[model samples]
Target chain A: MNVPLDPKTLVAEMSPVSTSEHIAAMKKALLKNIQRSAYVYRVDCGGCNGCEIEIFSSITPVFDAERFGIKVVASPRHADILLFTGAVTRAMRMPGLRAYEAAPDPKIVVSYGACGCTGGIFHDLYCVWGGTDNIVPVDVYIPGCPPTPAATIHGFAVALGLLEQKLKAETHVEAAGETAALPHPDIPYALRVRLEREARRMAGYRQGRDIAEEFMALLEGRAHTPGSFTLLECMMEAIAEERDPRRAEIIGHLAEVVQQAIRGEAPRGETP
Target chain B: MLKLLKEIFRTGEATVKYPFAPMPVCKDFRGKPEHKAEDCIACAACTVACPANAIGMETDTAAGSRTWSIDYGRCVFCGRCEESCPTSAIRLSDDFELAVGSKADLTRKAVFTLADCACCGKPFAPAKEVDYVARLLSQSARSAEEADRLRLTASTCPACKRAQDVHHIADMGIARQMTQELETTP
Candidate 1:
């Protein structure tokens, strides 16, 4: 059954709340001068609760965020830092704004998780506002699906001015005479394709690519070396030297593919 | 009190000194996706692989360029981009301290020039991709003429290639095609 939707409740794009110069100066002073304990209040604007779990874990004995005087309070009124988690769904927008208002002035607003930062996988959803910045001005953004406990502590340290942020905006423009180099220029393209296809069929994409790269490196290395042994003999020797059974098995299969290519036969396991 | 103190001393401190000390992360930790733009061909494979659309590419035919951008704020750190990158240009590094004061600081971009098509003279693909494919094809080509032909084929756009194929087929006279079709049918 489809429920009737209300057009009046829908929001397309809400501009981020503008902070006045006075308020901005006050916030800068608060960040610079404040040496007191920072009490964090978490506002769930409609999330999967993964960020909450990571937050809770950060406060646990192993992490013990209390060591730095960072405490998670029950009320937003007492919160020095407001940590907003989620994509800010339409239904939770009012509550999220209420929490933002409830926090005292000079409060540091933190957008937590990928969802809170940029709505994550749900950015295009009709109900989501995209990010916390869409509703209230955010002072910091902690991005991850659910940031690890260590990462959470690092984010807090960055917020409290204890640590500096590592990431910086970067842009690269194409330089003159710049070109991407081709991989394995010495190897025949057809043989490389056959080997890669065989390896990919055996393993998944990531591991398959890795295996193919290793096999190709070995192939190229053999070509450069002056040797009495044939290519097949070198491959057999390498296979015998391999310690891992699984990797050895994959190398053995790749060798078979190379042999088939040498014989001008079609790749195995495919309909003619 | 003495027994409690002794047990506490035996257990040692439970809290970890994180901020002051360098925290150790396990191997294969998926943290931030680092993009090596120099090695990236602007193929848009990572953009297509991104589940959250954190990595995106914009092609401008008028400008004759393709721009690749990645928003760290929206990234889920799933390593799908790393998996999809053919050149190993993008990989997840251990630097997880991604908190930024500004939203603009969370983004990275790379602009690459596009190669214009050989036939239509319109920007179609990244220049690096066309070059890389031509090089790869030439490596397997039997003769110098074949290699040059493959290079020409690689440089042409798909639309132009299709048009060439149609034109080639049309050059075979309609009467000849009809006779061949009739003979096959009989």
Candidate 2:
């Protein structure tokens, strides 16, 4: 039997926690002379539990984060690293702060997943504080919807100064006379549109676009060659060469679309 | 103890050599969205399609520039940007290692010049986008005159096009009324 804490007593206005100069100096010193294993404690504020699953997976036998002496502890009091996951909700903000305070001095705070990094898709939510850094100081940010096991390990390594951060801020400016090239200039735009639409209707968006591009490339290659072989023959040859039945069927359907365009006939399911 | 040791030897190692050796990801892994600014038209399609508002565009009309930005921290790696991109410019690449020490390092930006409208001389759209549309229309035009007209239409802003449409409709109405009057008199 446990007594629940009163919500009124827990709800109080407090400023963001700040580390003093001594704590900063101690953290730097700890990073430099750290010889022992770093224990991690996961403090989930208001995550969807996707980050938690990945975190657990990272410590499993397959990823084995324990190989680097990183252990997930049950209590923040025993933690050297605090892995914060979630977009800090108003309700959980106090508990999150308490966990941060519970952790000893010279603690490394690693913000895990996209939500923890910048509140992810829930950034604009009414009750969300946007990110973990909005409340507590974050040493590193591991950005992904739910970071893979490898990414989690990499983030830990970055937090412990075992590896350098790979991403850097970059800005690209448009050069003088810069222009985007038209895709498939040789193919008729109407025909290209029809082919793309039919492919997308048959397959999914991404796969359909890929298929349409491949078909156009083949058509362009054939047009460039000095052969008298008709486009139908070329398509038939392509269909015959394709090993995957599903891909072959899609290509066949696209070829039918091309044929319909060539014959000047309106596609099916529409009144001319 | 001997039997347990034998079982452990038979089971072998299950751990992966990650952070040292390259980890192989699946083919359809939704990783980082790589933006090719060179190929991008800055049409704001990705910005509009982004569910998390991770992709954004800021149009500076006074400066005649449009800045496109994506915050990897806010990005959910949903591939919506890749799907909505018309130019095939933004794509989801297989690079998922996006940990950073600073928040600023998680942002990527591209600045594109804006095109002045042919009629109003105002910065209306990205120069690359206008140029791409004009070329695409010209390529599809049946005749030289049609191609020229289509090119002009692409370069004109929407407000100017609407104004031209109103004038053209008024002229047609006057012509039709005069023709009806002449026919009735005869």
Candidate 3:
């Protein structure tokens, strides 16, 4: 039953003074966080620059990460976090490693973009040095071909929390180090339950599975029959169209080809 | 130690369920490669800009043109190709979970097609490129005197013609898609 809305009764039940004090303390902590500041330096061994452009925009007026006391420094010495972009190339390995080392003690490394995560599409190129994991001790891995600005910001926030937790335990605070292992969303039940003799495993559903198989089939032409569309002809169409370069909707343009190929209705060789 | 164990027990476990449940990437996290075909002008800007040489392109001269091939194995995810793209035909996205069993299975391709010229039976490019350089010629040539200049006798070879045809249709499509990459969308 709903109780009558009364400030006096609400205070009596809620412990208003204690609640107010707790809020004040939390506010004070948040303000303190903003004052201390955190420095992040971005390193681009060799990248397409799309990721770099986003990184540039993040520090701009609109996405100003400085509001959260996070600033991108140009030099590694002043940085608390090392932001690495692109796939680490043969030439870049030394510099990237040096950059990580220069970031001072209590430093963390955050590899941004899929290239940094696993060398991305360039996984086995001649010059590729693999992912950042091959080179140094990485505290956090931010996966994406090139992470969006919001994701970059949020990742840094998560890194900041990790830093705090790491430090708390360093001085003998004795907190659980693996708390991040099980995220909240993965757990569906509101209440905890004891496990039986055997735990049940649910079935799994996948999204990229079908599309990936279809794409691979088209690329290899493993499913193509005689007189069917050739991979070369498809490649020809892509090259010719790209020459005009609208450069605006490239992703959508690619999607169309992917869709057409998946349907097996892609235009055959040529119409004379 | 007892307090530490109690706090850990109280919070329960935080392991992400695999296959069935995956961790959500942060907002703006770059993941997979997504193409904006409408904005792409069928230009090979992204291909030319790629440092890892992951992007491969082919152009069919007569019917349709412009094709892009991405060899993920060769892609460095440096994103240089996306940035240097004069038409901004390519972009790196926020998808990271792109693992496959066969290494050869990860190559991706994209395409664009263009219409041909009705009068000359040649593909000059999309009508948008020159807004029908050939069509305007056709209309003005109604008079015998103007017919000489109006007639387009240009016979591009098979390879060149196919390339032109693809660009003709693709320009309109790419123009729509690469706007963000180009940064000049009206």
Candidate 4:
């Protein structure tokens, strides 16, 4: 019983199941007015289980996903919504497809977590298909490393039509004569670099940049009115106002560095 | 039964009023990466720093434009892009609701014009980046001549800069030294 198999047919065979017009219309109706409880079946293709933990947490007492009539079911047979929670791996492709097929028609497919949406950090891996949409048509995409319980709830809300999706695709084109303005035109570039380097060395990049910006603002204020107040006096005032001891110490250190720069002396803590 | 009812009442409702009311997020909550395109120099720092390859850039030399794009669906909310940004063009905002109905809706893009090389007519880097660097160097420059030199250096392409370096080295009579070494070799 040898049947001749066409190469083109084999290639086309791997494509995702196409929805019929009846099923599409039914899905539209389901999305429009889904009054009953939506049973969700989580399909873990090849995840690290971080998304699973978040999903369970969303169902917990504090988050209470059941309050919205959303329940996690054991089998796809009982599911009205399929929650795909991993980057679709080569090994799990058949299983993922099986779960999708097991679920009833007009079922909503949700691409959950960063992995499920677009494979997250593992997008370029050899075995991965990059996203759930590669294997199944996704009705909703909930992106996060592993979304928080609240974020998960919001995603469910969007999926169920209870809430609207906030993010819209945006494209910004450079207009004629549009230019990025200099951050601090008044401050010397060298001094700004030194100050930013010192601040970043003390605090982390995020906090360091913030502290550097604040210190530069203070320096600029003093520079604007040299006769009004001394730079040291202004620094002392800033230090006094700061509640955090560590931050105050960093600010003091930055002030000393500024003072050394002003006096034409090499930076204090570095080897000459 | 009364004690149970009293206990339930005392506990209160544990569910959050999300979707209906605004949810309060903690300080430094890494949710959605917001890009202030106006401040961005199109340096591709975020694209390089992004762990998920969510941030990407495409340069069309023919079009004389560079397009910067981010697929939120692929972003892991790691904050690496925010950290690596020199001008604070990109930062993680508190907005977390990123669910989308369409795949295309999950992407955001920005287009920037490319600057032509001072030596060659070909487009090289982003205009904003070259302008920003030129301005930064000029700010630190000691004299007007030095500022002009810095501006020229910033605007020139790498190939032309290399060519200039080679020409300068050639003018230094390095070939004479090479011949001298060859004659002196035992």
DockQ of each: 0.72, 0.85, 0.03, 0.74
- Per-chain TM-score, chain A, candidate 3: 0.48
A57-167, model 1: which lDDT tens digit per residue?
999999999988999999999999999999999899889989988998888899999999999999999989999999999988999999888889988888887788888
> Which of the predicted structures, 2 or 4, would earn the higher DockQ when compared with the native?
2
| TM-score for each candidate, following the candidate numbering | 0.90, 0.95, 0.33, 0.92
Q: Would you list the clashing residue pairs of candidate 2?
A: none
How big a share of the true inter-chain contacts is recovered in candidate 3? 0.05
- Candidate 3 to truth, TM: 0.33
Prediction 3: B-chain TM-score: 0.52
Per-residue alpha-carbon lDDT of model 2 for A1-272, expressed as tens digits? 23455678553444567899999999999988999999999999999999999999999999999989999999999999999999999889889999999999999999999999999999999888889998999999999999999999999888988899999999999999988889899999989988988887887788889999999999899989997999889999999999999899999999898889888899888766
lDDT of each: 0.89, 0.93, 0.52, 0.90
Kindly give the stretch of ten consecutive residues in candidate 4 chain B with the minimal lDDT sum: B14-23
Per-prediction tally of clashes: 0, 0, 93, 0
lDDT of each residue in A59-109, candidate 3, tens digit only: 775556776678888899998777777878878877887787787655666
- Pitting candidate 1 against candidate 4, the one with the higher lDDT is 4
lDDT of 1 by residue, B120-147 (tens): 9998999988888888788888899999
What range of 10 consecutive residues in model 1 chain A has the weakest lDDT sum? A1-10
User: Which residue runs of candidate 4 sit more than 4 Å off their true CA positions?
Assistant: A1-13, A225-227, A268-272, B1-4, B174-186
Q: Write the per-residue lDDT of candidate 4 for residues B107-161, one digit (tens) a residue.
A: 9999999999999878999999999999889988899999999999999999999
Per-residue CA lDDT of model 4 for A104-216, tens digit only, reads: 99899999999999888889898788789888888999999898888899899988888888888899998877778898889877688889989999998878999999989
Residue A134, candidate 4: Cα error in Å is 1.2
TM-score of chain A of each: 0.89, 0.93, 0.48, 0.92
Q: Against the true structure, whose TM-score is highest?
A: 2
